[model samples]
Target: MGTKIVAVYENGVLRPKKKLNLPAGTEVELIIRPSLKGLIKLFEGVEVKKDAESALNETRERKLWE
Candidate 1:
């Protein structure tokens, strides 16, 4: 298998399944099709969570994202 992507389904599974076979170190882009709930979940904590720079004390942590 070449970079197995976690398949997702809501009430019913999506069709058109395919397989991939590649050599070692073969990097590939994954086109994941997340369900509506799954897509919303990805933004759950991220959207509400405070920015690390604003939440973290300057003396307490070093932020790479800032």
Candidate 2:
């Protein structure tokens, strides 16, 4: 997912954006780098969120801390 770069836009022009057959209400994350080619990368935020949520849930369930 980290390696996926969905779009590349430049100088008011947009590159070929990727196509996805996704379900509604899907959440995505974008990394925008304006200093270099206006580079942009899209990621599946759901995956990251799921991991974080599980991690937090586990800690809460066990009352553990580092």
How big is the positional error of residue 15 in model 2, measured in Å on the Cα after superposition?
A: 8.5
Cα lDDT of candidate 1 equals 0.52
- Model 2 scores a TM of 0.29
Worst 10 residues of 1 by lDDT: 57-66
Model 1 scores a TM of: 0.24
In candidate 2, stretches whose alpha carbon ends up further than 4 angstroms from where it belongs are 1-3, 8-16, 34-66
Best by TM-score: 2
Q: How far does residue 23 in candidate 2 sit from its true spot (Å)? A: 1.0
lDDT of 2 by residue, 15-56 (tens): 537765667897766665433332122222324346777856
lDDT by residue for model 1 over 1-66, one digit each (tens)?
A: 455445545578633245445577876666655566665674466543567676445414643222
Clashes of each: 0, 0
Deviation in Å, model 1, residue 31 alpha carbon: 8.3
